[model samples]
Target: MLTWAGLLTVLAVLTGCTGSTPLFGDNRSPGDAIRIFPEDGAENVGADSRIEVTVPDGRLERVKVTRMEDAEHGQVPGRIAEDGRSWAPDKGARRLGLAGKYSVEVVAVDGGGRRSARNTSFTTLVPADRFIGYFKPENRSTVGTGMIVSFDFNRPVRNRAAVEKAIRITTDPAVEVAGHWFGDERLDFRPARYWEPGTEVTVDVGLRDVEGAPGVYGSQRKKFTFRVGRSQTSLVDARAHTMQVRRDGELVSTVPITAGAAKTTTYNGKMVVSELHEVTRMDGRTVGFGGEYDIKDVPHAVRLTKSGTFLHGNYWESPDTFGSDNTSHGCIGLRDVKGGSSDTPAGWFFERTLVGDVVEVVNSADKTVAPDNGLGGWNLGWSRWKAGSALR
Candidate 1:
């Protein structure tokens, strides 16, 4: 019914409104290719390490890591990173063989929702049978001044020379650094004295399946950098019943602390703070020597050992009993409220103790704290402890 002139006008109007048609079609992009970082060949990884994957021109939706010869391979445990592409292994991932190859697979999607995948095998530098330690107060940084670099091995190391060689330490101005073996599985690296404040430190661990003991091996290679913080080491001798807090070996403050009683003697040795809790429960039955009538709740317990020793607040004890008498079964009790909410002496001291601060106990009739208990590395004699190593 429309004339040619009218049809031409309508067509021209539509064409101008729509503009030119696209020759390349919709604005869709291609799928991305998943890739693994650290490549196909990587070495010197820590035993407790994670895997990383990457994707280009896309984002990874999922990832899988599997050890060869084992069917218990794993997919991504947590949320994948944005950009359609990266994956990290679980925090507690464990592999079978140390030197064997591991297969990793990654799946990704592009901006256009196109799917892509990648698979590759990588040989981890760290082996199974090995234990490696990464210590705190890293090399070359300001620390708590009382902090120390401590390592915990899973197995006892017998190869002292090899194990010691695997670890390297250096400090500013070249201070004398030594690796003191405190027990079969613990090694405390320190200078002759506390680290100098405002100084830098470096530690290198070059152990990968290096034999340490009969069946123990090491699987870590690391270089840590940290700085020195303030200097504070408080010495508490039970004989003096006085705590001398020192900075750079000079006396700062001396506070009086009541230790263990004669019958229930406190441990005689150097102990480090393993943990701190504002208020924790103390079970008498768990430590072996309690009937139904015994007190089950020793509140405000700040545990110092796995064997049930603590520096806790005791509300049952009199307020004036702290500095005068040692009445606890084996622990050092400080006066506090019944519910562990009190800010008494025990609460204050326990709150101030860091996880690594050294608390020396002497003159106790009880045996010294074992080096293997908690982080009590200071219990062992340096030379004697070193002799226990197989590498020696």
Candidate 2:
């Protein structure tokens, strides 16, 4: 005696009354609904990964991620998106260690004050032993200075061949790049010498999910391009009392320079332009070379070492003494026309040179500067530099 429309209306009212009931008839409590974007059982999350979640007909109240143990309780530092509908952690947190299963959960509340949750689990891919090393400068776009491509491994590498094979470097003009390990976790890539001026350089990193060591894996494939600028070199021989400035291997100037005294001979071996200064104070005690009468204001100084070495304007030294004497403490003294003008040999070199220009210091008695000191790691021999790696 019931009409079809009337019966359907009654059924709809009954369904609304049973709000927040389980979508699947497991007969369990109408608990939180768990919806995983990229789905509940997704595989192959890329290196640059961001996870997304949604709650059907509900607003998310809170979300948390936890290890399978569930004891840690979703507290690994994730970021909620501005829209308040999504969350992700920085690359450092997202890099998963070991091939294993992981879990994510979200909680939301519906219009009827009914709560729901959705849970998802995914298995991460087993990382390969071999991975490609990405090469590129960190931030700066045009490679004007000492910009070398380097990588910071999420895990310490145990097999050098595995990582080395993954790293490949090439240039438009066929410039070569060599890899040198600064330590267990850092690797730098550069040519045997400064890059050819105006050469186009590209570095490719295909090392996603590659096992770096026990319980660690890489999470990225990186690619970047940089343009090499002018080729320039500055040779400073402490004993010669001269700095030969060259552009693209051609001599440009032979400026007389005063070297460090006998007790403080300039450091021998290759160095790079780490920084430049218009006018800076040179404190004697700061470098541990101060005597009772040492002056604090050694002006117009350009620092070359953390140990207080400089190429500065010398007010104390006469012009005749520049090319003839190695007096005072450890510093490269050049004749300047006061006010730190760029026309002086010291200023000209400083203006033309960038932070990564090669400065060859020869004919000194001191040991070679450590490659790890500053960005001078490029000075290490290829075989010797490779030996420092845990993977090698």
Candidate 3:
């Protein structure tokens, strides 16, 4: 048994050995000792700005950055410095959105095994003008082999290289594809050759807040897919007065046809079938030949160009003219009944045709179609087509 003085002495020695004075308030929890770049509540940060954090006496365990408006969050991938003192977001994650607020959170652990967290927010600079690119063919659409992925921009892209890099094309059974800029307003993508039949194609345009020029920014983030259908191409020989149709490279039919007359000859080159109709109106004035003819309900019309051009039934003309003569204002005319009978040449052709079918005009007196006239990129040589690339 120990006396009261001895027991008090033992208790004092034990307390002195085990006790620790609290350095952070009364709880002894480690203080948040993180140093963040672009400091807290920063404004007008650059779109390409990066986030970095340093812990003098600790190591980072996790970091996250999120867009405030969309709540889109991404984990910041980083590795501790060899000395284990500093951390930074990956190089690829430096592309922040323009005119947007972002929230950053970091959690770290100290040498004592106590966890600490710090959060910061920032806003990116906003530009004066924003541009967007509208794309086609539409999502989930099944089109023929001649279909080209096209993009039309609302504003001109001066920095063509930057814009082109932002656009991406992918195929399931991968094929090499390239993009060509047609002026500053249009961009088109296609393989060196036509897409293989039944190929699945996907387009991703990640231009959101991309700086296209000094004051012009891009504002589009889009994804769309299309599938290629069976192959079909038609050859229209104006001099021979015939149209030869082929399916999967096999000659299927040869029908007599009348191309445009001498004064208004049809454009000669490759064109894609963009639209088809069983019956539609054809007004000469619409194609710049004022009041020469206005036939309502023309049968089995198929549109070939953005400008008024079509392969259509001509019931007003005598049937004999189709096989032997070329007499019309810039259109290919086939013999057919007024109401589009299935047995007629025009009806038969329309029924078998799908949007994106290729039509090439040969031996015509007219000059070759302008590359931008229709889907006429095929008219350009491979070298010339590649020369139009911004990346080239």
Candidate 4:
């Protein structure tokens, strides 16, 4: 339909307008534009290392960092810089797993609206030995004012400073608290004074990847909370052979009691009720005393020390022994029936007591209770307690 010259002109115009563009406009490949940290095939990467991505000439549209073992894939919340070229994971998001293999996928779009994708994988470092800390005052428990947050480590932490720094404690009304180390395997935290009634405390152990020692790494990351209940403290005067119970600082009752005998005296210090049992067996042979007594049904017993000290009912002792004579190996004795009826002194006291209630024993002939003997941390002077802190 057109002349040959005119057809040639049309072809020349078409070639000039679209010759450089292949089929679709600007079909040239974006060609590996995105850069990812912990580069592809990276080994021995830190667990706490932040995953990041940057585009040389584009803006990040989507980014995902997934643990390979769990296949837990989700968009990693990230913040793009003002220039829209650099991106990093959000601060408040959950951290990556420890000793894990991860896959990072990124999608980016340049100013021309061309999309480019990058996929990479890396592995976090594996510790030679993993350590963990078991914390107490169980999560969501309601405890007495004397409750202390204690941690028993599975492995001895040589880098005390690093381990201590990873432990965090916060309170509702806000109190100054400190951690005291008991040797290398135990750490306990408490305020200078007893916890305020009705206060809520939260503990965070962020020990993952913490170098607790050479070639030893901590791998525990957990959070727990506890509430402080009403204040109740019982004062036991060994000289007077009685216990004065107080609630909210008011004398509620004075109960007749008998403490440890003259030879094997009860520990003299502030102690916490660590546990309670309605009926349990007590054997002198088990506590280094060979066959002095073995009661199979000791009733209404409250544990006070790790070394087998208790405030329990002694149905075997005569009624006159209590409030009149100091007798027993190294425990406080209360009058009770053999079967632990609720009406007995031991049962009544046990019903009213909580695990964290404080019991102070005075005028006893024995040396003061060791701070680590039970929940007897309060016996240590404030200066001495703080002196045990690695941070100090």
Q: What is the TM-score of each candidate against the true structure?
A: 0.55, 0.54, 0.66, 0.67
Give the per-residue lDDT digits (tens) of candidate 2, residues 1-392.
11111111000000000001111121121332435554445555554455556554546666665433211123445755555555666547755533334566555556666444444555445445533232224322455434566664534676555665576667889965667776666677766656767878776665566566664556556555667778777788777787887777778778787776776667776666644555433333334433212322233455455444556666555556667777746567776543455556656666776655677788877777667654666567767765665444
Candidate number achieving the greatest TM-score relative to the actual structure: 4
Poorest 10 consecutive residues by lDDT, candidate 4: 11-20
Give the best candidate by lDDT.
Answer: 4
lDDT by residue (212-296, candidate 1, tens digit) is 8767777666677767655556565665554565655676455555566665567777665654545332333334433211232
Off by over 4 Å in 2: 1-168, 204-223, 290-308, 337-339, 377-392
* Candidate 3 residue-wise lDDT, 1-392, digit = tens: 11111111000000000001110111111233666777666767897676777888868765666664222334446666766677776666557776566666666667877555554566666555877665556667788889877776766889998999998889978998878778889988888887889999878778987888778888768677789999999899999888988889988888878887877777888988876666544444334454555454466777776665688866666555666788867778777765667677777789988878888888878888777765778888778888899988
Q: Model 4: per-residue lDDT, tens digit, 1-392?
A: 11111111000000000000111111122234677887776766886786878887868776767664222323456777778798887888776665556767666778888555555667666555987675667667789999888887767899998999998999999999999999999999989998999999988889989999888888877787889999999999998888888899988877788887877787898999977767554545445554565554566778787666788877777666667778777888777766676776777789999989999999999888888876789998889999999999
Off by over 4 Å in 3: 1-128
Rank the candidate models, highest lDDT first. Answer: 4, 3, 2, 1
Point out the higher-scoring one by lDDT: 3 or 4. 4
Cα lDDT of candidate 4 equals: 0.73
RMSD of 4: 30.0
Q: Considering summed lDDT, which 10 consecutive residues are worst modelled in model 2?
A: 9-18
